[model samples]
Target chain A: MLPNLVVAQAHDSVMWDYTRKMFLGDALYQFDDRIRVSLPEFAEDSMQVPVSVDASAIDESIVKMITWADYNPIQHIFTYHPEPGMLPQVSITFKVQQSTPVRAAVLTESGQWLVGSGYVSAAGGGCTLPSESRMNDDWQSSLGQIRAGRFSSTDQPGADRYKFRIMHPMDSGLVANIPSFYLEQVELRSANGDLQVRLELSPAVSENPSISFDLLSSDQNYQLWVRDNDGNEFQRAL
Target chain B: MAMNSNEHFEGVAMVFKHLRYALMGLVFCGSWVQANPLDYALTPKEIAPNTWVVTGLTEDFTTQNGGNIVNTAFIVTQEGVLVLDTGPSKRYGEALRQVISEVTEQPIARVYNSHHHPDHFLGNQAFADVDIYALATTIDLIKSRGEAYTENMYRMVGDWMRGTDVLLPNQIQTSGQEIIGGHSLRFMAFSGHSGAQADLVILDETTGVLFAFDLVFYDRALTTPDTPGLMQWLEDIEALSLLDFKTLVPGHGEVTSSTKPLEQMREYLKWLDQVLTDSAAQGLVATEVMRVGIPERFSSVALAAQELQRTVSHLYPNYEDAFFAESF
Candidate 1:
């Protein structure tokens, strides 16, 4: 049996169990500590809550990683597939409606799931109201704009941090008159045209999606490509 | 007892009518107290010659306090009363104005917003007719982020934030010495508090009082959501301590005559920086970092644990990025 790093309470959360059954469909899973989910204890702004999920500690070979919020109106946050030989770690921002448990489920190559959990308390109302970008008359003009950069860590000589932000309102369609609009696909590729990772984002993401990834240092430049649900494509080189 | 039917019916009807009236009176008095707790209960204490400060409670925002957690003051000058900052909501601003009037007959001549934080400037709606002044960058920040802050305030404080709207300052204030009436004032701008380009700090050379806005929090823990960096904030505190002022009015907490507030701020900032750095070096996650023990010296500081948690949330990632990325 796998080490029971996380208590049964995490798996026993009524909402989490329901969500797991509904989404994972009785897949073999266990609450494991190797998968770590980090979030604020109290979300200062319900609109933008930072979340980091790292599955690099797991000794098993990973297949894919999926994350969700148990209480979010749109529970699915993202599903990330790290390309072969890439580390399974990502940081992103999302909207939370209220206090909820956020879980990151990592699927290992052995056909088992390892889950990490964290709880965040919020002041509520993250998805009900329309985003600021939706209200701007000129929001369309700046749509699909991308600001991205990669920083080399001075302490970790062989590590690089990639941070990027895309200008698109990830409207959850919960608000009246605003349809569900969000980045549906994101791809990171090396200069030599090698795929690094691919991410599927849900409307649970905050407006103007910003994401960060930690990877090994490389001399080659990288390009990020994003596609929204509306079929609009945004690309930038970092 | 002979013809009791009609008389008995009339008496019962009269009793019911009187009961209804009494219930209505009780409701009127109850709601008069409940719905009207918007009163800020502002009392201006004269700190210096013609200078008065209206201090707020050193607590977090709540419906009960109505977001009255900032210090706003006014200088009754020879020309007119120069207001420092408007309080949190329009009601608080109106209360501040009324308190100012009670102290001196001088009309509000000029108004200055210390920064773009909602608590410091949301009250701008009350002083709509006055020419409010702030740094050009501050005005821009208010325009960009003020609405979101207003929304968050409404969520945090509920009904207390009603009628509060974002009102942009009309005039631009720069760093310089200006003589208003008989008081010579020096306006300085710093960016350690709010990540916005600047935070306004004012010094009354004539009165020897420094209005060190959000740059200095005395007994209360300083907020760090929009701060550029803790080291930068420490530099600002160091510079502020060098200012020649007899009376120091921090953005929060009580007014002081000694340099204890500055000393406390400096020591607290240094300690916070050390904690973040050490936690990062230890490869601790945000949750672990937040749970780290705070020093006993900070026991007297209000909301230290809460603010430390918030700071860890806001800044720990940068520290973690500096550490190892073991991909085992």
Candidate 2:
């Protein structure tokens, strides 16, 4: 699993020092080779950049996983607690304000931080831009629409890729009158009712959240369940 | 122990050989080619009498070629010329203006933006003095999302967008026929392709030329980043086929007179819709759906494989969501 990691970040040494101290809170962190961060080298759309964190090698011993952007004004992106029977791997789409270090810190059952980091260069202003859906009058009626699909991985053999998006305002509370509202939790499950992955999100993600990840299986049947902070639950099967 | 003189020379020769091979690899791979300002050398071919179009290359946006992948046209009448949708950047627009000047001495009087897509309207800055027209919804969308599109284009094409800026069209194009330069032009606004009240198809009554801007793609695969659905786009094509036009200028690809391009577009879109909807109903995830084989009928369409992948990424999730709701 470590050999498949793509190390495109040029400032790995410097980013590790700053992000480790900022996120780990002086706790001892081992640069776990099994942890991998996958993101595009250059963000095509700063508003909706896709990122995935794969820690399947150490899934059983993981407790909590925290992901953040070191250069964002709202640095804390999300934190996930992989439920029992769930894989430690998860994918999410979020906003990035420029070229910044994105770090994922995995806390193990033994209380050690396993750190993985990558860099994504953005065109800036994803965090502050107003939602494009706001321009339409029927935005409210269209909220909570969910879409999901899957494809076989071309690069990673035996692994299938999955992508889904939910229509929501994902308001960051920075804009006047629009309070903080976003999907709080998402869970993916197999046809046999086994948890595959879990995600925790915040307002830092772009509107109409698009999430994508790879499952190391050829199985086609799966279900995606999501809930917002407002108690709006949505589910889709594919 | 220090190396002998002969041994040192041998080690240096090996290092030089490795360096030479590395340099050769870079050249052979052509991975070092950076973004450069493209000389479009735009030439307008008259598809109809007094109406000319500058065809753009049917290719994806790349740093090496910039994002000049759009069709722009102009109609010269007794009055000044009326320009159609502009190209991708300010430079492209400036070059287009030069080409138009060489064709006729008439000043460009009015500019019509087919939709709010950056490739259709980002060149508005070059026609600042002229009255640019677009749908009201398009004007609003550009005001809201123009900056984000501009930033994304800059990252995709790099320095080619150096002088480009987001310039919104001021005039509103109501749904009706209007006389411009003694030629009766009919305009209909629809929303299917770009989803945000986009796709404006213009028809010239005198010359029987239809400027179906992003609404039609000759041989190129359609873009779906903002598409509402395949059904709506099919309806749009049906409406376009009803028009009495001898020549058709699509948003991308070469100009043509036959209805074969429209037929191809309809067949491809129908197939895509069926494949995605059926896959979702069968409870297949995006990965599995993407692996579904492309029919040989669409094998000849440019970027069919790649565009199919993108379409799955964009639309399959919605189908899955609908399927889930129905099951529940």
Candidate 3:
């Protein structure tokens, strides 16, 4: 039984090796469990599923994090760079094609790769479906607009919850003739110019990406800076 | 996934059937014990000689109330009855049917859905046998988004949505007049409150009663999650106010004989649009706009603060884009 268990472990490593080769190329790293991925057990709407990744347990050693859906046709989702004074946590909404395993691989300054995974069961065709914003004629006129606000948490004192949304089509390349145009990075900063949270996004993120997170500070002043892949930058103070 | 009928013996089938019946009995008993009568009981008030309306609570959807927060009306004529809008759930529809029966023995000939809002059309499941009519856009949106809305209602109001299913309106309505039940009912489709679907306004030529669903919210604050433009909504109100009507039944508020509701709606929407536009012109983000002080006049409006906060999120982006374009 002990030998069989060892063989099974080897098989699992072999599968991870193939996946890593497909995504990360020839990068060498170690798997750590400090990173965590959270998603709904069953996706109520395949077009918009809430997803969050928390690497707070890893402290300040993390430099970048990459996430993907293992079964999606376009497996690459996004890559994040946590700046100084930023928490290693992110929340974003996404669109999944079907029931698939979602993985978040975090890379630390020490060259360690911590992987966390979650399964989201979807009915199907979130990618193939036409954009919901297509119904509106002036969707392009409102692109890159951001709405940001913070509310004090009633359940947890001293925790201010920040919620914001950016108006973007987030068109997936899979859609016919709708080139991949999405917000690539977002940075939330305090009044003192300290980075609070940073997010890297992709086309998989739903149109008008809405996100919420908790800030441990009581300061009411903050600013949001966002830049899409097309080099359109927007910044606003809250 | 095909079932193998020959694999299971007669003995397994007998035991399983008995077990299933026992489970079903327990389920029925549990639901009966938990059911509350007040949650489903909605009384209809007669605003006109033959028109009756069931005004829903002004509060938001909750697990206890089960999202019974919209107005549903019916008109009885010489031939049969015509329902304006269905309530929020299957149970509400059934209760409404009982109330209609109590009022008159006339059969429900046709049902008209005001828009694609789940609160307006989910009750179509109860009157599936009748011809449910709506605008073409409303029908299309309901067909695509009905299931998601039903799922959301279940999550919101819990068991109040039990046995509730998505029912699409089968008939399409255009901007015209129809003589139904010996009354000249004029129907108009206009866009405002809901961006995806147009609102339905029906006017009975006999009583001059206008069924303005979601187009005019009297005392309560209007929902803007699907509102494409406040300007468009204001224009729609202007158009509606011009019509000659004796009584107006809004989608969510109380019925009124005067044009006070239309005036109040126009005032609120105009003020809201001004606030958002000015805030955007100053380059204030959504959070800053949400913090702006509400005018003294709007302070009395129900959910004014809450709806303003939501409206900023929905419309500030377009305002900001307009501001940006102007600056350049």
lDDT of 2 by residue, A161-194 (tens): 6666788988776666667788888888888988
lDDT of 1 by residue, B118-210 (tens): 899988887888899999999999999999889988988888777889999999999999999999999999989987558899999999999
Better of 1 and 2 by TM-score: 1
Q: Highest DockQ, which number?
A: 1
- For candidate 3, lDDT tens digit of each residue in B193-284? 97744788899988899999999887788988778799999999999988999999998888999998998899999998899887655544
Q: What lDDT does the true structure give each of the candidates?
A: 0.85, 0.79, 0.78
- Grade the docking of candidate 3: incorrect
DockQ of each: 0.10, 0.09, 0.09
List clashing residue pairs in candidate 3.
none
Model 3 fnat value: 0.00
Deviating ranges (above 4 Å) for candidate 1: A1-20, A24-38, A45-67, A78-99, A103-118, A123-238, B1-36, B321-328
> How does residue B54 of candidate 3 score in lDDT?
94
**Which stretches in model 3 have alpha-carbon errors above 4 Å?**
A1-238, B1-38, B325-328
lDDT of 1 by residue, A97-173 (tens): 99999999888888888788888999788988799887775679888887655666455567677766677888999
What docking class should model 1 receive? incorrect
Q: Native-contact fraction for each model?
A: 0.11, 0.02, 0.00
